[model samples]
Target chain A: MIDRTMTPLLEVRNLQTHFFTDQGIIRAVNGISYDLHEGETLGIVGESGCGKSISAFSILRLIPNPPGKIVNGEVIFEGTDLLQLSDREMCAVRGNKIAMIFQEPMTSLNPVLTIGHQVMEPMVLHQKIGKKQAIQESIQLLSKVQLSEPEARMNSFPHQLSGGMRQRVMIAMGMSCKPKLIIADEPTTALDVTIQAQLLELMKGLTRDIGTALILITHNLGIVARYADRVLVMYAGRIVEKATAKKLYSSPSHPYTIGLLASVPRLDQDLKKSLSPIEGQPPDLLNLPKGCAFHPRCRYRIPKCFTQSPELEQISDNHEKACWVDVH
Target chain B: MKSFIINRIAYALLILFFVTILVFSLARLLPGDPIQAAAMFNADLSNQEIVSELRARYGLDKPIYIQYVIWLKDFIQGDWGTSLGSGEDVLEMFFRRLPITLELFAGSVFWSLIIGLPLGVISAVKRNSWLDAILTTTSIFGVSIPVFWEGIILIYLFAVIFPILPPSGYVPFAESPIDNILSVILPTFVMGTHGAGLFARYVRSSLLEVLGQDYIRTARAKGLREKSILLVHAAKPAMIPVVTIIGLAWGYVVSGSFLVEYMFAIPGLGRMGVDAVFARDFPVIQATLVMVTVNILLVNLAVDLLYGYLDPRVRVRGNLGQ
Candidate 1:
């Protein structure tokens, strides 16, 4: 039998993804590493354009052509290096083993086809099932995602469905093949809070039932609080901190993480005090600073913090932080 | 649905009425008298006799409105009296020529769609490759080269140079469908090339836009093949714009261009329109313009109906309207 620690479901030693634009080579996903447990939900949190989504896309190799490139990275999943896989081989791994749902449901869903066809497409490709059987499974998936009148919905096109229904359909499709990992990239951002809660709850239950791991990528700390087992905080393409959901919320080590948690409206926060925002915009990925990327924006930046870069090192048995600050 | 049809048909009728009025008035406004043009060929009647006979024959002695009513009444009954120039029944002659123009459009559109869609999808999926480059270049050629120029070139090379395909003529579909096809094929392709290029390029761009959408990424992430990602996910919505282009192209092919028929020397209405304009045959010109206008409006209505079927929001809104 394989050693449990050695055979983690996913492991990335030093992944680095860069983008070659006309302006300059932008390191969208700078070197970072994390391991995913088979059954646990790993929430990847970062503000927009911090390479949170790009990191996930690089794992799937779904980044668009020309400008976006995974210059150096090893997205190790299930004991295989995905970056080494050929286009044909990567395609096989993409839909069956790992799946991703994008942010916008309205544009994400194909306009012309019925949701049924889009859902069954993966089944048709990977399972080698006939059209009729694929369609039946599609109906079942629609209902599984909590859509009512699933059978009638089979004939209806994407525009016929509402935003929430479409997002559910997206979830159902991602779950169709029972993939080992599902990347939900801001799955609920386009939606309001109530719908976001419902979708999160649905995803949690479905993932649990199927024994599938989930990579819930979102900016909202509140979401990861209840849903994720482990949380990886990213800022400017680098992992700033990694901890269990409870520890990350109650005891954030990185200043960025602290700012994020503090910024969230809380019952404990002073009523008279205005809400705190991240001090400044993210560092320009093209022209990165001399030392810590977050130095310009970091509230607790020391001389060492500006001149020296910090690596992610273990603080506790499971918790880790990448900041230079030595917090007890 | 009923309301849509009713509204469209009413609008078509209104447009058709204006076309008729414009054709009738404009034909009369042209300098030469139809009777004088007729007498020019007669060689027997004096100018005075020609004027009186034409006046009596057309009931031009009556008020212009009365003449219009009489003419419109006769036209509705499919008796357009006689050609002001040929003295032959206008309806009978139009009917004889009508099938030719319809066959040209029907044949060309069918070929264009069959060729355009695959070319478009392939170009979209295999973007920036040499194959796409060739298709893009060829489609550009198809779009830029005028139908008449292409027709002349094809005839010179294939018919004149190779002498394999028949030169140019019309065979009734009933007489021999094979000959009918041979007769219209060259002209049809020449006419269709631009539409094929236009449709394929537009459709490719549209499909590319949809393929880059989030759900498509989701489908890809789900491991759906690149082929299905395009065929199932991208092709359907991309076709909306394509449908509009096809409908408009069909109208232009039906009404605007007579060069194809003129080059091939086919006896189609487009050619007849040219002849009527030259000879100043008011009734024939009016009828032809109205027919083409009505056809275009009808096809646009069909496009809207197709949109309803493709998208349910339209259908639901349709129901709500009802």
Candidate 2:
């Protein structure tokens, strides 16, 4: 459990990541902000194309330029504003203090490189460790991720491993440097249901044991319910709702969040009830609505919801949601 | 692995057999009689009886099928027939000239690799920049210019204007290796420049594609330096397609050696092949075609093997017959 009364491990402030395309200026991560307490998992939930992945990329300053840029943001990690770090300093912080795992384990690893070489890379780069020692440590890390024959598996290529095993390798690599933060962007999306549960369990257990803060980005609400301590529900590149996981699950304040929860077919819910999926498509980032981006599709949208964009306002302690409509 | 090599070799042999038939038929397609061609050189022996004697001596009076059978039989026995023009044994003549062609081939390949790969990397890394534009523009010139014209330009610059090198001719590597290198240098450049341009284009495109792969992003995310990521992680897989281009270029350089050798006055297989074609020397022409086809097959096989080595995924998949 995280001690939220203490200062958060990471604090993102009013981050704005935009893409300057010939067609238009597309707002990808539009003024999103959240706090991640130490040793806690923060779930960033959104439908596809809702800037979930781009926000994670922006935190690391890994967004591609020319088209994509972090126009304005303060990603403060460990008391330093990461966005202000020099290239050299950022490089030092990237893999040593913070690491990330991507969704597609199938393609995340270099095909030509040996698994051991990849796992050992960060140790050598950031830790300044010797190759032999790094390999030894990497083998142990592989085993820690529950991979059998870690020594032999070290020499194997990414293609040789099963999807589940490859995801395990990714976890091992992410944990190699024992970084303080790990941003997993849809890590279990590529795995089947069984493997997904197993991989998530392995990752959660490891992070807990190491006392590392994690930011799990996924579209799966069920995963958030199972793993996250706090949740940030994003819609149209903004944090529409933020609350402790239990509070958010019990009383989701945002209509979008309510729609999200309703979309999932709960096993405990009445057998006769049907899942009600959100009706409209995600808004185009380049051409959002005049006021509230979600107002067009929002089932509880009042006339005010169409004319005015709602800012996140605190309705209760540690709970906030953006909504113009008044709901009992 | 053993079985794979054997399978490739078996397939090559089958192709070689078909190629021999094709070349044998095609070489005879030219509108000239070998007997009459041989007779033209000895105009004094214009009598019908002498002509018939010469025809009989060369087995020119036989049916096409019978002639092919005899040639195949002799070829299998390592007995290439006498050349129509020189009366030299075809095998002996080709063997005598083989070293020159091999030197040119080796030198051109070496030069292309040395010049092509680094330029390609630079072009791809600095894509759309001035450096990339310069390299791309020069490579286009390299590709567009014919090898013989490039050879002529080299001659005019080095031999005529600068007098820095011998414009043409070959030196046997066994005799004075330094002199041989100097003599072959100009022709090698002419031959290699075009190939280098080709290589640069192929390498640039393939490298660009590989650099865009998700693994490359992972490499960057790992905090590995840009240099290490490009060279270590990206270079090998990118080389797969470039390796294929090199293999195909190897075959082309060998067969296309005719103009290059002719322009340089080098006594190589290409020159011999052209002379054989002009003189209607059936045996020599067929033999050279066979050699060229075999070289092509062998080079492609080497490429396939190299591909397996560079990407272990391919090797494992191939081994599993998947």
Candidate 3:
């Protein structure tokens, strides 16, 4: 549905994803929802196994079957529900319209093919172009990603490239179609800090130039601060907080968000003091705690908070947070 | 790459040394006296004189080390001595059978790749479907049947029922390549089917695993069609293991698949080794065994190097034996 002034390019409403493992049914993404407007970066931040990546997989339907399932959701890109589309139709939408950059680069590339062929494949298949045209486009994409000697690199296999270069190739492929929404799930998590910064900056610049909506999913607060326009902080498969980058950094309401920000080593803080990591482990998705999932790990866990799960209540005109302990 | 070649050559010499000495000693020690072989080998010498000459000529009376050293030096330079049965040079005799063995090896390798790789990929991509079931059943039959038994059955059908396809014989490929191919097809098929069946299953499983990877996911997310994703992204990486198996099987086909040669009446190295053992021609048998070992070893070395070449991560620095 269209907003009054700015229609969101992608709107995921009441998404519920589950994993039926031997242990039990894990509610991976429990009733999470978000909106991405045109040319906006929506960053989903959470610790490992907190459904940040799972939610992105749900958008692409890349979740492996017989284990993971998107039980309920409407991934409305434009007006079409991606879940409802047939396999063929979904494929057309996948690279042509909505692209995703995965976490690992080494395992992501095909070992047997030249880098040129890997990039060219999507162009030829989706675009229905000739081999020459496909190759030309591939070279152009490689050059755009700053790969030197495009023709030579084209003949070289994935094994020939460095990790950073491979991630850049992944980014290049994601940008190949100039999709309306590019879901980059921990794209730079595997890279070194310096390369990570370079890739993030490149991605930001590229997306801005093309007006491509980005769903930047990660656990890094610094990355969120630098790249994201809005932030969704997930904990135990639910969005605990949602706000603009400025507001989320200044005044995070949820206790999990508060603990996470506190845990990060601040450059401004005393170097002599040891970092205080949050006291408890993340609540198991399979067997969650009663009432609020964060209760056992919280310092301000009220008795009533243990009896009821909190819904996302609007805290400000452009910010919302899910917590029983509301900021006055 | 240069280091790889040098390493292979050095190790190959060691392999030749041990294998030749083993075949030579074992052939000499077998129940029938090698004295009789020596006597049979010499037409001019008297029986008593032949026995004395044999001890001196073979250096059998001397320490085993002395015998091994004399043999190893000549063996390195392609001098396998002379055959007791034919009086032909062991090198020449081995070469005569080589054409046949190589032809069979080439045919089997070609057919296995042509059949196995595609079938395996199809089964994996269409896993659990009717086609997969059919391929699974067919490949199971292919693998379960022994090459010898399968060879005989094939002859019975093609040779007897059809009254056509020549059931047995060895013709040089150079003499008539077409005739050689035709004569050898049945034996090659029987042998190739085993590898084809094994490779197909490996390929399918390997492919499915690669297809499941996140890189493959990235390929699909590229909006490339399914064909390109399967061919370019999923197919090649999945094939690393399959290539490995095929490469290893080249060794097996060169050495282990002797029964195929026996059934088909081909004069390959396997057949020559068997014939040499029966005749108690120690030199011929030892020479053939060494040649087979060298061929198989070189094949394995090449494959190892190929693995490194294909994937940048796998570096073949030296030949460390298990």
Candidate 1, true inter-chain contacts retained: 0.85
- Candidate 1 chain B has its poorest 10 consecutive residues by lDDT at B313-322
DockQ of 3: 0.50
Q: Mind giving the per-residue lDDT tens digits that candidate 3 earns over B1-322?
A: 6786687778877886678778767766787755565566566544676577776876667876777778778888878898877778988877777777777888887788889888898898788789999998888887898777888889999988986788998677688978877898888888888888998889888888888877777776766667867766676567678878877787776565578888887777887788778887777777776777787778777777777665555653344333
Could you tell which candidate, 2 or 3, scores higher by TM-score? 2
Candidate 1: what lDDT? 0.83
DockQ, per model, reads 0.60, 0.70, 0.50
Identify the CAPRI category of the predicted complex in candidate 1: medium
> What does the lDDT read for residue A210 in candidate 2?
90
lDDT string for model 1 (B1-322, tens) is 7886787678778878887777677777899767777777777655686679767877867877787778788888887767777777878888888888888888788778877878888898888799999998888887899777788889998898898788788788899989888888898888888878887898889888877777678777777677767766666667778888887887786454488888888888898888988887877777777677777878877888887876556765664223
Shift of residue A41 alpha carbon in model 2, Å: 0.8
The list of candidate 3 runs beyond 4 A from truth reads A1-4, A128-162, A267-276, A302-307, B17-23, B37-82, B87-92, B126-144, B152-182, B312-322
Runs of candidate 2 with Cα error greater than 4 angstroms are B319-322
**What digit string (tens of lDDT, one per residue) describes model 3 on residues A97-162?**
888888998878876667877787666767889999888888888888888788788887777788
Q: How accurate is candidate 3 locally (lDDT)?
A: 0.82
- Is 1 or 3 the stronger prediction by lDDT? 1
Better of 1 and 2 by lDDT: 2
Give one digit per residue, the lDDT tens place, for model 2 in B1-322: 6778788889889999999889988988888778778677778667889888877887878888898889899998989888878888989988898888988888888888888888888999898799999999988888899887778888999999999899887888788888899999998888888888888898899999998898888877777777888989998999989888888878886577778898998999988988888889888998899989988989878887897899897686564222
TM-score: the better of candidates 1 and 2: 2
Candidate closer to the true structure by DockQ (higher is better), 1 or 2? 2
TM, every model: 0.93, 0.96, 0.86
Q: lDDT-based ranking, best first?
A: 2, 1, 3
